[model samples]
Target: MLAGKRVLLIIGGGIAAYKSLELIRLLQKAGASVVPVLTRAGSEFVTPLSVSALAGHKVYQDLFDLTDEAEMGHIQLSRAADLLVVAPATADLMAKMAGGRADDLASTLLLATDKRVLAAPAMNVRMWEHPATQRNLATVLADGVRVVGPNAGEMACGEFGPGRMAEPAEIVAAVEAALGAGPLAGRHVLVTSGPTHEPIDPVRYIANRSSGAQGTAIAAALRDLGARVTFVTGPAVVPPPAGVAVVRVETAAQMLAAVEAALPADAAVMAAAVADWRVANAGAQKMKKDGSGRAPALEFAENPDILATVSRGALRPRLVVGFAAETEAVVDHATAKRLRKGCDWIVANDVSPATGIMGGAENAVTVISERGAEVWPRMAKDAVARRLAQKIAEALQ
Candidate 1:
């Protein structure tokens, strides 16, 4: 999405400063040339040589370097790029920006820049919640500086809260959004992922082998295309992608509710492996052996058909896609499922033991629609996701 853009990246001081290197690589891969600037404190964490090598440019450090001043002044340097990105935007740096302090090259550039600026804040939880920092945040936001994340999680100090810097991929999404790139821009897509667990009891439950790899890849691909994604996920081995609104659920009924709440979307991809049944007469405590040599009788109840519900709902999206993981009759079953579910399309795949697709990294899918079934070659799940995202963009367009 960032084909011809130039980005000015400022690496600030913090343990998270190391992520700036990955950010540089991602920006470069997205077709943007990066001009890196390292702050004095930032230098202590990552060397200028490392940043320069990754960015493929000289790392700017001093505000008053005579040679740099002779070639391109700070003002020119500030306005040179289309956007300025501050990674590991320390509390101190944010305070400086808010108070109009220009004691260093990084702050000076931020002050002189006429271009858009995006900051990724990273700090201790208490410091982030501090009144001074909050006030600074408010001031910078009022000044029209874009911010990405300080996601809640465990910290380097053995503490936990919303003080972690956003992952590199998340920052890239924010950049794409800021630049207004990608075909899916201004579009909203809902994605359901993972396998739901139907509780037989508090400790034991019925589950599946789904790793959520495909679904996670799909969400990331959609985000990269500039779509605002709402990811409703079940308990799975894979982690949800960053830069998307995530709603986590554990049962088919809960997944359906989350999907409904995320309504009015342009499109929806139902990729979750929701269990078909639940124990209707589950025991309050763990079921114990009675020594009768007979198993306990458990009644089975059907789970909510999420795809069908969405397709027939009043707030149905423009396009509804479902997934069918079958061990037999994959094509025939998927084609019938498309009609039965009333969805626009169904992506069917074989997940038999021999296929190794149940929890594998690769996928071979057959996309069934009213038109016909189109078989796709087996490939990495990520590649499949990118292709599907592109198709969704085209369909939406």
Candidate 2:
């Protein structure tokens, strides 16, 4: 999506600055032109030569370099790129940005840019969580700047918390979400994900084993295509992708409500493994056992069919896609489901334990439609999502 685009990368000083090298590689791999800007403190971590070599563009460092100024003024340089990215955005750098400080070339360009900016923060755990840093973060976010991560993990200081920078791949995804051809641009997409829990009691519930990886990946892919995505997610194992509106729910009923509320969408992808039933009469408190040998019987009630409801609603989206996780006759079941649910497409997958697709990392799907089914070979869920999103773009267009 980023092919032939320009991204002005500002490398900030920190141990995490090293990851910026991989970030540059990934950005270039996506066909984005990289223009590097190294700060005074950033020079301590990575040599300008290294950054320049990887970016294939001269490092823009000095605020007063006569040669650079004569060729391209700072304001012109800021207006030249499609985006500005700050990897390993230190607490100090973030503070400066929050305060609107433009004392150096990096800060000046940040202040001067007319394009959107994405920051991947990297700091010590305490520094990241400190109230001051939190305040600065809120400030920057309020100013229309998007932040990727200060993911939780072991830092170079041997401290473990959310101060580590996001991986190069995750950062790349964030970039794609922010700046891409966005074929789905100006389109609103509603996506549901994960397994919905049907509460039986305060402590017990019925649920499925949906990891939500595929749905999360789909949302990211759609965002990369420039869709304004409303992600209606259930209690998910994986975190929701950044830069999308997330409405979290725990039950199928709640998921349905959220989906309905995000109506008039261009497309809807119902990927959640919503439970088919909930307890007819759930206990308000924990059910205690008396000294009886017999067990209590529980009555079942049908759950709200979120996919069918949205597909058949008065405000039905232009494209409605459902997922059929079947143990046998994948294509047949999915084809039937597509008809039964009144959805445009159904993604069929085998989850018979041996397939390892229930909560696993990869998937093999057959897309069932009115035209027929198309079998897709097993691949990572991310690849499947990209393919699905592209298909969605075509369908919507």
Best by TM-score: 2
Clash count for candidate 2 is 1
lDDT of 2: 0.89
Which residue pairs of candidate 2 clash?
182-225
For model 1, how does the per-residue alpha-carbon lDDT over 1-397 read when each residue is reduced to its tens digit?
7989999999999999999999999999999999999999999999999999999999999998999999889999999899999999999999999999999999999999999898999999999989999889878877878776676678999898768898898788768867878778999999999999998888889987789989988887787678999999999888777668989999888999999999989999999999999899978999998999999888999998999999999999999999999999999999889999999999999999999888986789999988999899887686688679878888999
Each model's lDDT: 0.90, 0.89
- Candidate 2: list runs displaced more than 4 Å: 1-6, 9-34, 37-58, 61-81, 85-181
Across 1-397, the per-residue lDDT of candidate 2 in tens digits comes to 6898899999999988899999999999988999999999999999999999999999999999999999999999999999999998999899999999999999999999999998999999999989999889878877878777666668899987668887888778778768855578789999999999888799999999898988988887788668999999999997787678999999988998899999999999999989999999889999888879776689999988888898889999999999999999888888888889999999999999999988886789999988899999887686688789989999989
Single out the weakest 10-residue window by summed lDDT for candidate 2. 173-182
Q: List the residue pairs that clash in candidate 1.
A: none
Judged by whole-model lDDT over C-alpha atoms, candidate 1 comes out at: 0.90
TM-score of each model, paired residue for residue: 0.65, 0.69
